[model samples]
Target: MYVVIFKAKVRQFDDQYSQTANRMRELALTEFGCLEFNAVTEGDLEIALSYWPSEEHIKAWKQHPEHLAAQQLGKQRWYESYSVEVVEIKRSYKSGSY
Candidate 1:
């Protein structure tokens, strides 16, 4: 499994951001083969983690038209700065199943 971690400093958020974010999450899961997606924000900081089966899926999601538009808007208005990291899972252990 692969994980994409997106950490950022938020700027502004409103209805449009909410709608786009939900839509993008759906697209990533249903269309791009994302295994799981989670995100959280506190104060001015935001962090999102998306799990994938392959890097190709992540690349495709990054280039998706709607996602590209959202990225542009993020840079223009939604986020102040961001960093993305892609990592491979080496091992995993879960204490409980949900």
Candidate 2:
């Protein structure tokens, strides 16, 4: 498994941001093979974690047209700054099933 960590400094959000975000999440899960997606915001900070099966899937998602548009909008309006990190999960332990 792989995880993409997206940390952002929010500038502002509008209704379009919410709709686009939802659509993006759906598309990632349905079309890009995303295992899971989660996000949270507090104060001016936002963090999103998306799980994936492979780097190839992540690359395809990053270059997706709708995602590209959303990224442009985020840079122009929704976010002040952001960082993304992709990491491999080498091992795991779980106490219970979700």
Candidate 3:
């Protein structure tokens, strides 16, 4: 498994942001083979973690038209600064049951 870590310093959030976020999450999960998608915000910071099966899936997601538009909007409106990191999982551990 691989994880994409997205951390952003938010500028603001509006209704459009919420809608776009939900749409993107859905697309990632349903169309792009995302294993899991999660995001959270506190104060001015937002962090999202999306799990994927491979780099190919990640590249496909990145070039998605809607996502590309959202990235532009994020740069223009929603985020002040951001960083992304892709890392491979070397091992796994579980504690008890979910």
TM-score of each: 0.97, 0.97, 0.97
lDDT of 3 at 56: 97
Candidate lDDT (C-alpha), each: 0.95, 0.98, 0.98
lDDT of 1 by residue, 1-98 (tens): 99999999999998999999999999999999999999999999999999999999999999999999999999999999999999999997888775
Stretch of 10 with least lDDT, candidate 1: 89-98
Total backbone clashes of candidate 3, pairs 3 or more residues apart or in separate chains: 0
Model 1, CA-based lDDT:
0.95
Name the runs in model 1 displaced over 4 angstroms: none
Q: Candidate 2's residue-wise lDDT over 1-98, tens digit each?
A: 99999999999999999999999999999999999999999999999999999999999999999999999999999999999999999997888786
lDDT of 3 at 33: 99
**Clashes in model 1: which pairs?**
none
lDDT of 3 by residue, 59-94 (tens): 999999999999999999999999999999999899
Superposed by TM-score, candidate 1 places the C-alpha of residue 11 at a distance from the truth, in angstroms, of 0.7
Q: Of 2 and 3, which scores higher on TM-score?
A: 3
In terms of TM-score, how similar is model 3 to the real structure?
A: 0.97
- Candidate 3 lDDT at 87 equals 98
Worst 10 residues of 2 by lDDT: 89-98
Report residue 98 deviation for candidate 2 (angstroms): 3.8
